[model samples]
Target: MLNFFLVNRLSSQVRILSSLLVMLLVFILVTVLVKVDTSTWTMEFFALSLVCVAILSGASNVLTASVFGVTGRFPLQHSQSLISGQAMGGTVSALAAILDLTIASNVTDSALAYFLTADVFILLCIAAYLLLPKITYSRFFGLFSYYMNLPDEPTDSSSSEDPVETVDVSSSKTNSPPIIPILKKVKVLAACLFYTFFISIIIFPTISAGIESVEKYTGSIWTNKYFTPLTCFLVYNFADWSGRQITTWIQVPGPNSKMLPVLVFLRTFFIPLFMFCNYQPRKHMYEVFFKSDIYPIIFITLLGMSNGYLGTLSMVYGPKVVPKELSEGTAIVMSFFLGLGLAIGSAFSSVVHLI
Candidate 1:
């Protein structure tokens, strides 16, 4: 909706710059949250912070996609970079949490350390964005500039030879709404994205957070204490990063293949499967199937890898399916759908206890 309103009024570069400002604001907010005593904070402050993060995240997605779309030359590799960055973020957060558990004296110290690390990364992003347009190669391709000169596609003279074809082309151009056409073109991509995140978000962070190794297992105490979280978050991040990296080598079963959505939908099994995997809530009712800690480790690794692989495929392929002029808007729309999947999946995760 922001894109609908602001795409015409502001250049993509300006919108992206505005998103950077929003990110900086978020980092500042995190800093304040960390520095201020927890006793002074209330639910309202935390709620407001969440609201701010959601809005800024959506804005950033729109602006980034807009820049890619408007530039016309940015390719799937660029989209891959964005997806890889997201995976990297999870990997970093996981490492930070591990460090916090191992080294931090208290929860407060851990929070402070995590927030400071995040702030530094946010600053680095701001610096990179600031310098992007100043460098010639980045200016030409990385940053979207209204004045960037691009060669126009050569018109086909054969269309002029046939009056019916010319009239059909003109009429089609006149009657179609720009966004609607692109949306139709990339409908499968949107659905693929929705399912990918829906399956992932439903099981991860919520359901996965509850799973633990059986007490009867003879693994080390640290492994028993931290194994679930490690498998759910840290191992997941590493496996996810590996899955995303694999795409760079092979993009098998290209975007148009019917099998992609099936693969995504099949991932729904992980929810129930993870739920049954020595989960704390149901440990009494269902006997632990696999006594060894290795079962969940293997499952989560596969889950994370699938999430990264399918997600990267959807992100990179979605834009390529659309015309270059519409790719940016299409990418943003894809992001919106991806967020929708997460929203729906999160909502479902909240209610899984009723099941």
Candidate 2:
């Protein structure tokens, strides 16, 4: 999709148009889903709706890649801010889900509230996006213009004196397949991103939801009802948000930094470790060493922090290693790799039940 846009000189509108379309799609889908009674909705239809939502979610990630790609050219700070904001967005959504689940009268109301809230937020995002171009001297407009003006390819140093020679060299390079060089340049960053999201997405939502505070750790009725999910959600998201913010002050694993991939891959240990916890489905299978609330909370916090820090490090550092013209592509590719990780991790989660 982006290649088509770039080839036709439509790159300038890629992010805005895609994001606007997605927001609108989300609004309509949520509204329709809310209106239909789940009791009457067939299992197949529900599954179809989930598939549509997943497609739209992937589209949203593409838009995020576009935005991040643009920001990558400016400075590391801009990329860090983009990632921190994403973490904050997750934290907010998790809080909303928690509130709906705990306070609503029943599951139906909770489901309705969640969809309604999502629709409202999408509407607001659309409104804000519409207002962006109208604001004079807006950073959004400035960034768009900056990206629009960037050369499609880096200028050769010899081009000023011999344009023909430059063209010939570029044509030869293109003939050999241009993507290979880019893949080589960004291998480390892409690997880091892949491993980062792969580790987190596999354990979260599915596996983490299975784990619980042991029977002995229960406090009150509320704790019995929502303590495990709520505590885990808050601890993980708060830790993620905090770790991202920390990057604003502390910079390590800068662009092309070797430690980033190492740190990210190390998180694979989380899978087996989490699986051995007192997960609701498999409590009888293991000794459940992490039975206390403190144990999982501490580990989850670390997991979240590592996810935020290392993921941010990869994005911020990726563009710096490539030529200025290729920076946007590099960032976009990294985002795509992250999505790949998520897909693989989600697939892996499906098999967790068998264990």
Candidate 3:
């Protein structure tokens, strides 16, 4: 919520640049923190890490809104690519985590090196953002987005002059944006985005993390130590990325069609399917209907892929639902609802645990 407020009041460039800087700072902090033997400072280490993570997450929320607001101005493909790239980043991070766990002998040093490497990339992003104005592609869209924010002019039935040429330069000061109507225009898609992530947050890492391999009788390391990471993290992340990529080729349940929300709401069924898996230590639901590893592998893949595909469609459709002039505000509002979904779903998870 704080991040949402900041994005509303701050300039786009300022929000994005600050987020990148915060990311860089986090990388540095984590890099240095890992070097110390955390055994001695366990409480302090974890406490500080939590604080950093909270701050970084806020920055990330701001960045999401900023990306949507900026890309909402351009052609549809740009927004689609932005979402795909985010999924790709998650895939890379998952791969890196697995590699670090399996091969790195010195966990501390390897993790530190990982942060350092990430910092270098953050630096590159900062430089690229700084240079964005110099690039014609970006400058063109930046100006175009500015032009989009102008208020609608009075229609003149008889005036034959080019409308673009007659835009009053001072009109921006006279007209205030209609936030309520803009939000109303996008409320349906905003609901789609919210419920999409809501279902995702409720299932993942909560019910999904509890799911275990049924092949535990073998006592193999693959079924024990690596099963969750491989089946849960790698499979889900890759599938999610693949789903985002699939949108480039095929986007079904078109933006405004009723089919979109129908498909999104259908994902709720996955929760029960997961609950009946080989999830250990169930207090309330004891029946393990799905005993084979295959069920979870399939379910998680579906969960991740559906999330990617449906969520992206909602986001891409948000800014376009309203007039071009209101696109940026609409995009930011979509991001807020996305955050709201994740928040409510997270709270609901504890209720699920009690049940």
- lDDT (0 to 1) per candidate: 0.71, 0.70, 0.79
Ranking by TM-score: 3, 1, 2
Q: Give the winner by lDDT.
A: 3
lDDT of 3 by residue, 1-355 (tens): 4544554346677778989899889889888877777898789888998999898888888888886787887888888898988888988888888888888899678878888998898899899777766768865666433433433443443453433223342344334345567666677788999999999888887878778888987999989888988888888888888887787778788877899989989999988898899886688897899889999999999999999999988988888766555566678888889899999999987777654
lDDT of candidate 1 over 46-161, digit per residue (tens): 78778978877776676566654543346567667667777988898888777777677877767766767766876786687667667787555534353343333434545444
TM-score of each: 0.84, 0.82, 0.88
- Rate residue 102 of model 1 by lDDT: 69
**Of candidates 3 and 1, the better by TM-score:** 3
Best-performing candidate as measured by TM-score: 3
Query: How well does model 3 score by local distance difference test?
Result: 0.79
* Clash pairs for candidate 1: 69-328
- For each of the candidates, the C-alpha root-mean-square deviation to the true structure, in angstroms, is 4.4, 4.5, 4.4
Ranking by lDDT: 3, 1, 2
